[model samples]
Target: MKLLFIGSRLYDDIDWYVKRKNIESILTESNENAINLDLPDQVFIVPRGMDGPKQVAVMQNVDAIVPLIGIDPPLIDVAHMKEEIEQEHGIPVIAANVRAVELTSNKIKTKKFYDEIGVVTPEYQILDSPDDLTLEFPVVLKQGEGQGGKDIKIAKSMDDVEEYFKNFNQALCEQFIEGSEISIEVLGFNGEFVALPPIYKGETTLEGTHPLSKVKTGPCMVQGLDNNLVQHTAYKVAKNLDSDGIFEMDFMYSPEKDQLYAIEVNTRPNGTRYLTTATCGVNSLCELVNMAIGEFSPANISDKLEYHYSTEIPVGDYNGPCPNEPVKSFDDNDFVVHGPEGYQRLTARADSKKDLDNLISKLL
Candidate 1:
């Protein structure tokens, strides 16, 4: 089978799988200097948009297309392209459709969607001005579009809200829930959806800590929260979306209130993949390829599921023993070190908590 993958940033994560499947890999990158360009069978340096990749896919006669984009900006364009190409060329694009992107891309629309679906999300109000704020103090003030904690502020008072409004006129103001932060990856294709184990991100703090800066673990052991509830809520959201590919969602569970509130959804590859893979032994990126090849199914995913204790730590630099070639990617080793030099993370997994601790200590 031949595949056309857009964006080279995430190509390395699934390069081994692509090679193992003996798929002809054609990749397109907007930047000529992007990494992982040499791994694909054919590389095309195209302009920054879906148009270039779409042209290359048609010209090369690729059997399927999978976009490996991680950010939110390019998803709408990719969704548009997927609609046009899949309808006209009869080739599947393993990505979310236009309607799915439209709803999830905007935080306001996502809040409305959750309300419609009866999924509990934090109470929020769209603020045209700081004076119009109705949520209580210690609320999250952010724009409709951003990722990785960009343009986010925890407003504790009117001054903070006013300060936030100085730069942007409107904000999606959400009531802050002091609870354990969680993330789960839900994979869906051809009407089949499976929500993987939820990963425990750190607690919500008044100081507004981004989850990326905290140590995280899988099979979230939140005291009062149930894993099945998280999985069920995620599945409901994904089924409502009725889209293809990965849906990485963020949620907050308040112990005091005994509530699980949906935060956001990212319809692409994300930073949570490494930890999710370490925890469950199911790599979402590789599953995208499975979806492209007509091999993705709920039964196949269930067979591959393995329960393990996993944790990921953010270390500025890693100076540990390497496992093998592509040490950053998953292998038979107990630990996988990934990320750039200055911002690295180590993910370790084992059969038990004690074993997981030992593996992390030995590796770190």
Candidate 2:
């Protein structure tokens, strides 16, 4: 069947579509970015933010549309574009509806949905006014549509809270839940769903800029976690929101209080799409396409995939170098990157963390 992969600028998205055999794949890009070789059936680079019918008409001949756009500040509208595209064109949407995407993209809205369904989230308050800072100090405030802790701030005192809010427009304030934070990636088709093994998020620092910002994801963090609990919780969120196809849900675990707080819901493929697939052995793109084609059944939904874990490290210490193009390194030795099925290792080389950090950080 013919499929149009939206948000195709991302490497993972491109890789996903290209890997599927015997399918017509059209990759759309926002800007004139370079595409990795070995592409799928067909690739097209559409102008950025071309969501209106005039733009999407390019794919009127395609059977279904699969969006691969990442989360953005205008995320609610971005996600809702799925429905807009479907309605504008007489094609079937392979994921959540516009209303559902709106609910999940807006943090406050998502929390309310979770509350209505009896799902446990954090003790958070949406600050519509300056006086809404009635909560005590040490509260964490994150940007509603922000990612990787870009505009996050911690208020140690009421004064600090007030001062910070004056600078930022939209934010969600929550009582500090001190403990390890864990994130899980799940893939779903129709009403049937499968929760992949959870991954541990490590060293989330807001030191230089934002503390609540995400730095890196490690192996499964808390052991003996009720996998069933995580699965049930995630499924409930997906089902409650009537989410379809692939999605990612994050959660925070307060070990001291023994509480599980539901975090934000990623309505689109996350930055770590490859990492999740590496850990879970689930071809989200393939499965998503299959589900879109009505190939999923309840009996085959729970087939668990295996994922190994590993980390990124520098190569060596050859300090002094002066050249036009900067140098880099990757560690094949460090045990940080591992999986049972596939051979995972550092794909490049560098000297120090700072030097290695210069590599293209984004997944695109």
Model 1 TM-score, 2 decimals: 0.98
lDDT of 1 by residue, 51-87 (tens): 8999998999889999999999999999999999999
Instruction: Compute the lDDT of residue 325 as modeled in candidate 2.
Output: 15
Tell me the TM-score of each prediction against the true structure.
Answer: 0.98, 0.75
| Candidate 2 deviant stretches above 4 angstroms | 11-20, 34-40, 50-60, 73-81, 84-90, 128-131, 203-224, 297-301, 307-364
The candidate that wins on TM-score is 1
lDDT of all predictions, in order shown? 0.91, 0.58
Instruction: Quote the positional error of residue 328 for candidate 2 in Å.
Output: 20
Which candidate leads the pack in lDDT? Answer: 1
Model 2 global lDDT (CA atoms, 0 to 1) = 0.58
Go through the candidates in order and give the clash count of each: 0, 16
Error of 1 at 356 (Å): 1.4
Model 1 C-alpha lDDT versus the unseen true structure: 0.91
Question: What are the RMSDs of all candidates, in order?
Answer: 1.0, 7.8
